[model samples]
Target: MNLLQKPILFPLNEKVRLIQYITGENSMLEHIELSIYDIEPGGKVSYHEENFESCVVVLSGKVTVDVLNGKIYSQLGTRTSVFDKVPTHSVYIGKNRFYTITAETKTRILIAASKTDQSLPDNLIKPEDVLIESRGSYHNKRYVQTILSDQDTISDKLLVVEVYTEGGNFSSYPPHKHDQNLLPKESILEETYYHEINPTQGFVFQRVYSDNRLLDQTMSCSNQDVVLVPKGYHPVGVPDGYTSYYLNIMAGPIKVWRFHDDPEHEWIKDRL
Candidate 1:
């Protein structure tokens, strides 16, 4: 129900923690953003989005979706994911109200006064299309996966990876960016860094711009923090003894895994 503007911080607690919508409207990617809902034991949110596609993942407790597939309410399993670009489905939490993330996949265009067509858009994914990767990508390479994302395999592919590192830095030593267009097999993808440093933890500075003299500026990011990267070259720096993680959501017009690092930091590539 809300779009993230500035990074909102959430403290770690013994009980369940809930961080609602990351953004309101424009804050979402392609009108899609992550929603974290906290539900109490036996709590439930009625399913019924006139025009919204929801995908649910259980980070903690188990949840069952008394879903309405065609006619009857088909009960889904724990950690059940649904690309509900079809109809409005309600959510009912189990023992403890669990958190649910909802992203809009169905394309709904406006026409007249609040009234528009309800036909399923081309991007509207089927229930089966919500593919979940149990075992993530890149186990080593000094990387860790937090969130399980269903990588979009459409024409233009943007890979979203929630990565964490132990005393290890990501995108370290090298600053990179791709600001061009190429064949589907070799295209350029923009990079953005929204940092989240643990509390009682040190700070991390991110430098972004078009190389040197490209309007250089650094921002101090911490827990529940964020930084936007539309274009230009950028890199992240995490001091020692601190752990960190980030949600890198991507989308392009092609289905290829290609990237280009900044000229200065490209040297570290050979070591990897």
Candidate 2:
């Protein structure tokens, strides 16, 4: 299956230029929907979800989010590039809520959604509230920012995170899969990776494959490219001279994340 999706350019006059990375109508995903919106200043995008919850992540510039009931969140972002290596701000909107986002400046946002009936209050996630972790060691090292985790019952099935892999490094290393719903072992989850290259012109290599090679594809993904992982052990490798950044959105029947690493590559963990 061809899982790599590239964004089609839209004219600047279009107040809101949206690229639907993954949606129920377009993909094999069962629980997640991902989209990217590039809104010019003074532009607005509104949404009302009847049976799904969503989280809006600011990738660049600033914006204000108004959740219809006179609740307004203003100036919600900073940093002009994902390469800034800074934690971003995001807003979580529960099912049955109506929210509008107005760009205070030229802004880019990523929204991830999943089916849910959880009656959670809408909340804003600040940069300081994000947990930053450094995983792996040496060349396999990568920095991770956890946006939403299972510990936070505020969300139903969505798990969001941002990762930064330095030049000539590896991420999602030792190839792992979470496509089985066995508690304490692995949980079934479908995921989407939205990638951005530091130099913009550079690219990263991502591989999606099953043990029997039933599903295997290695792709050269550029900026604004999205990769879907329906069922497989997926991993990424970055070429030298350019850094790679990607926002990952995952959803499944279970909220927690547990994975099984490929036995062949499991030994790599010992060296780390």
For every model shown, the clashing-pair count is: 20, 0
- Residues 1-272, candidate 2, lDDT per residue (tens digit)? 67888886564457888865578888888899987889999999888888889999999989999998847999999778888899988999988888999999999998899998676888899999888999999789999999998778768899999999999999999899999888899999999999999899999999999999989999999999999999899899999999999999999987989999999999999999
By lDDT, the best candidate is: 2
lDDT, candidates in the order shown:
0.39, 0.90
RMSD of each: 10.2, 1.3
Q: Stretches of candidate 2 above 4 Å error?
A: 11-13
Tens-place lDDT per residue, model 1, 1-272, is 12113433342233323443432254423322344444444444333434333334332233344334322223322222211112222222211122322222211110000111222211222234433333212312335332213243221233444444434464433565554575542454433343445533556666666655555666665655555554555566666777655545433333244456676756665655
RMSD in Å for candidate 2, one decimal?
Answer: 1.3
